[model samples]
Target: MDEIIRQRIRNSKTLLGPFPNFFYEKTPDYPQALFLEWFQVAVESSVHEPHSMTISTIDQHGSPDSRVLILKDIDNEGWYFASSSQSAKGKQIEINSKVALNFYWSEIGRQVRIRGNAVTMNKERSSKDFLERGKIAKAIALLEKQSLILQDPHELEEALTKQLIKLNRNPKLISPSWTLYKVEATEVEFWQADKERKHIRLQYNLRGEKWVKNLLWP
Candidate 1:
């Protein structure tokens, strides 16, 4: 790499800047309640793609891979997201059920981290989720045979064309292989960026059957 690019990468660690003015002992224990509040704040702050979050999963070899996915639903059950059953992330989840989801709202200077075990939703639910996605998204999902090697660009283009034709014929058609999954969090942490010194950190963990919440020093 060039020296300038290397320097920029090295110096990026210092950009976290001291902390900020706000500090909270904890972000309130209840996961649903606190997350709802944070979500509302993110929405009101005009954060673009607030529902978009990073999902990190580990393969059988224990190597980590991550990709951004939009949150499909959230409630007392768990955080929901969906993908094609054949996608790398979905396959990795099968091998290693452990996963982490992260959210960073740059405009509001806030972040949330969730560590959990994911389980696939039923086919009926998965189909509903897939059908709810926009037509173009459904078309794209149908086009990709993820994690497989491609020998020819024209082959993919041809596949995409055929998929689009099929999709156009029936807009309500859902990808048969698409899967929806929910990550049942074992632990969750909420971090609010601080501009000066101290910051807010709250961690909620599942102990036995009960949820225990704690505040961590930042």
Candidate 2:
């Protein structure tokens, strides 16, 4: 059985791309601009969850943890995402602000990796972000006990019901722990896969308010 599974894994094909000719493409001076261009392509290509990305954080014990999250916004400041301050990832961010974000669009055979420091936005911005969420999402945020052991499933249902009721009464009620975080990227790498085993990797490094771009060996 193990041999069969191993063979299946070994035979799996990857990096098959009718990929863009990024090798000859002119890249922007800023990583953000290039990222937006690639993101627009992904959206037009109908890539599933194009805004979804993996955010990796370092825990208190110095172990790396990662989870998929939807991208909230992006600007010159950096990439934005939201979460509860009391959640595991939030606590980890408090301990160590450094983080990495990865976005993969398999259909396009492209990926973007970012290493940066995450900082909490001001309370006004955070509250605005919270209010923009759907009622169900707002209710879940109000629960505020994320990553805690749920000994009783019924308790969650009851808690969610209560929060929904509260929302109905006061629509403006927002979770105090809900926070918006922005990642200020120091390094960003863009990778494009080729069918012929030659992949293109371009990296941008932040250097004293300037961005330096270089090609990397695949």
Candidate 3:
């Protein structure tokens, strides 16, 4: 390694990092409360696309795969995300529903980790979600083959254009495999960076019908 590059790596731990600009007690007793609070602050901050997140899944052969996606919605129902059931992530969920979700707001130097099992939303809800999507999104979803290598460079663009026409003919058309899946978080962790490296780590664990808060070593 170059000497200067090595020196830069050595200073990383103490170089860049936050107490957060939002209202947070030194220690939080409520996990969800803290999460929502942080989320709100992140949204209000200068972070671009604060709702963007990375979701990780394990394939059938037990290989890990992850991709960046927008967080569709979140509520008592859980974190909402949509994908084609035949897609790699969806197929992996079909075999093993456990998954991990990560949210990072670099502008605010905050991150959240959620782990839980993914469940497909009911057909009624799923269809409603599909129809509620914007026309272009619906068109893309209509092309159900996600993550597949295209034989022709223009294949997707051509297909999307064709799909748009069919959609225009029948506005109610919906894709069969476009599903909304929810991740019911079993455990959640919130991490906040600190200038002095005394980072804050708070975790919430679900225990038999209740959530328990705990502190973590940074």
Model 2: weakest 10-residue lDDT segment is 16-25
- For residues 135-189, write the lDDT of model 2, one tens digit per residue: 9999999998988899999999999999999999999998999999999999999
Report the error of model 3 at residue 173, Å: 0.9
lDDT of 3 at 196: 68
Between 2 and 3, whose TM-score is larger? 2
Task: Give the lDDT of residue 173 in candidate 3.
Answer: 96
- Sorting all predicted structures by lDDT, with the top scorer first, yields 2, 3, 1
Residue 157 lDDT in candidate 3: 91
User: After TM-score superposition, what is the CA distance of residue 43 in candidate 1 from its true location, in Å?
Assistant: 1.1
Runs of candidate 2 exceeding 4 Å displacement: 1-6, 23-25
Q: What TM-score should be assigned to candidate 3?
A: 0.88
Q: In candidate 1, which residue ranges exceed 4 Å CA deviation?
A: 1-27
Best by lDDT: 2
Residues 1-218, candidate 1: write the lDDT tens digits: 69999999878743164323334544555676677888887887788999999999998889899999999899887999999878899889988999999998877778899999998999899989888887767887887587778899898878877888998897877777799999999898888776653567788899977779877898
| lDDT over C-alpha atoms for residue 151 of model 1 | 95
- Report the number of clashing residue pairs per model: 7, 0, 2
| Better structure of 1 and 2 per TM-score | 2
